[model samples]
Target: MTSFKIPSAPRSIQKDNPIKFLLDSETIDCLAHNIALVHPVFDAQAFKRLALTNIAPLGIMDRSAHIAAALKATLPAKFSEAADILLQTLTPPNVHTDRLGLSVFFYLPHTRFIADYGRDAQHNSGEDPFDVAMRAQYELTRRFTAEFSIRPFLTHDFERTLNQLQQWLNDPDPHVRRLCSEGSRPRLPWGARIPQLIADPSPVLPILEALKNDPSLYVRRSVANHLGDIAKDHSTLAFEVCERWLTDADKDLKWVIRHAVRHPAKQGNATALAIRKAAGGR
Candidate 1:
């Protein structure tokens, strides 16, 4: 696994940039260590041995604000370039496989980075003569989908970046196909809570439906999550989706139910609790 190293942003491009203030390796290590203490026996070395980062001990809640701050600070001067570096850096060497916690930490930040960069490129002068926003989105997504299989993080901007990602999704890349599902999730853990998707989720329905029987297991997991998010706000819709999915008796769908319902169930939502009881789910 390669060590992820984003090129350091120079001061000239964006002076007194917040990003420059936040890209501190000492800070990241300190935060990572602090969170790692949550699990007494969690060994950081062994966890990083398998070409990934560990999420069990550190969940997203503790680190999200810090990571978001770091990434946000970077946007003014090096957004486009910094985004490229961050995505490249999040791969195996830079992170562990326990992606749920990791996604919460990085995905939301990444999405915001993309959005901020788009805004910056659109507004900033001397960026590029040829539509920097379009180019930046294109380059960012193109490189991102290649290394990471997480779509939920990448596709939070379907309306803005869909044109950029559509070709890749339609391409031979299975990763991109997986992304189509992962990126549209409504309640994707630490990822942005897509309010529209949580309420309606219709915008991404076609994408998930197309991926219901995807060849890749990785891709299929996203379909289940997309459906599960719907279950959070619209139980009726989730029930319908589960009804269809249960016909196939997929263990993965069960996993989605358990994960997606955990929060609502804990909150004592009557509908979720009833569904859990009826399904004999704990």
Candidate 2:
């Protein structure tokens, strides 16, 4: 990891500072509040000390709860410029997945810009350390779903996203594969619930189907989670799909079943649970 010098004032923060100026916007305030909440979870002083020394992305994540709101309010006026700024500010040395997770909102309103950045990152030369660029792509998709309702432009990329996900499922890198599922998941924590996938997740079904038996526990966990998201809206359909593969399912599949079925079972939604149980145990 290169030495990251945190920008004096992140560009996103500068461009969208007007929102900050106005009434102390709810989103910005929320980020401030969340940071305070996270302070106790991890010892702030120790974490900052570690950041000064080791300089890991995790350190940024520890502080991101505070940065999210500022990022959210700071959207750039132009797409190209925004992408350039985000890539410069958030990449390498400063590559903090958790923090980026929060700051990701900075790009939420302009997903196309973020997508372009992802494409550039994929082709650009550098260490590509920690697969940070790939993770940004994932976060971009995740936020796209969460912040904005599914629109035509977003749906247009649905197929491509699924294709990329499928390709990554077989990636030699387990983390990349995990990101594939995580990105596509309907209910990935803090990610958007892809209504298109939820209404008819057929696009991603085949991909998850292929990954149900993935070797990596990390990747398999994401597979289970992706299915679990589908199960939320299309319980019968998701259950049926899972059952069809029951005979082929391995230990990982079982775990997926448990994770994917939790909400339905907890809600006492017999219809969904019955299908889940018939497919397999808990």
Candidate 3:
């Protein structure tokens, strides 16, 4: 298998710089406050203490996990009930993709909360936990990404998750549509790896196809990256998919195919290069 390297972010942090900590103490406390408002029984101070304890030493992702753990500790023991509380506490949904600023990061713990506790949660309402999780992701994704939260469902229940993602392909929210592709990426950076998808990407090909001509560049970009991930392990398959798309491709789709083969084109893969050239890439 060929290698594809993703550059890591700078780990050195200026502890005193407030911007360095996106989910710092104040943010965690704010998260607690929001949950407390929706949930009458929640102890906001206890949640704040648990979420903030030793959080100063952690990175942004770790802080998300830490706070999610605190949520597990203090929230209702039943994952379904806790998920409902978190869902109720969400702020307004976002429509545009950029300029949202770091405030969007506030929901990181919310997404993490679903991922950690909702993976196998059982319910009495005859509603599958998958339904709750996907609904939460649909809503959570509107405000902040649920890409990270959607993976466990993908792994825990592949066919069911894929079906739900397909149903969401036409969702009005671009963020929700983006999740259909980005969440299923075989080699999603800084997210859980789907070894099965990594080994055989045929399953997600339909997803890539459905979103190939998406109106939002945000969604199309994820399709390109999803195809790019497929290229890493299945070069011929990736090139073939791009080649098929190029036959009657539009400007937007042409760009997606070009980007899909970018890394392999750099690595001198003949098929990738040919696909790139055909897609009008320099």
Candidate 4:
């Protein structure tokens, strides 16, 4: 297995000037205020107190982890109960909306909590936990993204998770379609690496094929990234997919193929170079 370098940001916080923390005071306040409005029983004051306690010492990722831990401690004990509250409180997605809203980004911590804490319960239950997580992720991505949260299921049950993701390619929501590719990336940034997919990317090819020419550029970009991740480990496979997609390609797909082959092209791989050449690259 190639030991791909993990980004330095996750290892240590920057020294002189700090990166902005996602779960800062204002973001927490916005999150609490929104949760309070939707879930009447939610204890906003208590939640805020728990969330902000000792938060200054933590960096960006740590803050997100801390917020998830706080939600587990403060929210309803039952996984479904807590997840339901989050699902009900999410802001609806709009077609014109390209970026996540403030409240939605803040609420991502809660979604992470559900995905992590609720994993065992959903797996053990008679019902499919991936489905449960997928539903929560679908709603969550509309506002923010469940891309990070959904990786656990992929690790836990690859076949079932990938199957569901394939179905998601046809979803009405572009976010959900994007999740199909983004969540399944072999080397998703800030996400736990899926060694199985990295070793054998055949599983992910179908999902990418389904999303290759998706109407949404958001989904197309994710598909490109997912392919690029594959190229890191399996250049031959990535080039094959790129070659297939490039035959009589439209403008959008040409962009995806070009992005997918970038890493390999950089390495001077002949097939990758040829694909780039066919795409009219200089």
lDDT (Cα, tens digit) per residue for candidate 1, span 53-147: 23224333333334544444433354555444444444332122223221222233344444544443343444641234444333333333322
lDDT of 4 by residue, 53-117 (tens): 99998876678777777767667776766777767656556564453333345656866775687
Q: Model 2, range 1-282, lDDT digits (tens) per residue?
A: 333222122334455353222222332333323333433232334333332332223222222332332332343333333334444433232222233323444333233334333333233343221234334454444332212212222345565545555666666655455566666676656444567766777777777777777877766777777787787778777777766766756666776776777777789977657656765665
For all the candidates, what are their Cα RMSDs to the real structure? Answer: 12.7, 12.5, 7.5, 7.7
Error of 3 at 45 (Å): 0.9
lDDT (CA) for every model shown?
0.48, 0.49, 0.84, 0.75
Which wins on TM-score, candidate 1 or candidate 2?
A: 2
Off by over 4 Å in 4: 1-20, 97-104, 122-130
Which prediction has more favorable lDDT, 3 or 4?
Answer: 3
How many steric clashes does model 1 contain?
A: 11
Q: Please tell me which predicted candidate would have the highest lDDT against the true structure.
A: 3
Selected candidate, larger lDDT, 1 vs 2: 2
lDDT of 3 at 17: 60
Q: Which is the leading candidate under TM-score?
A: 3
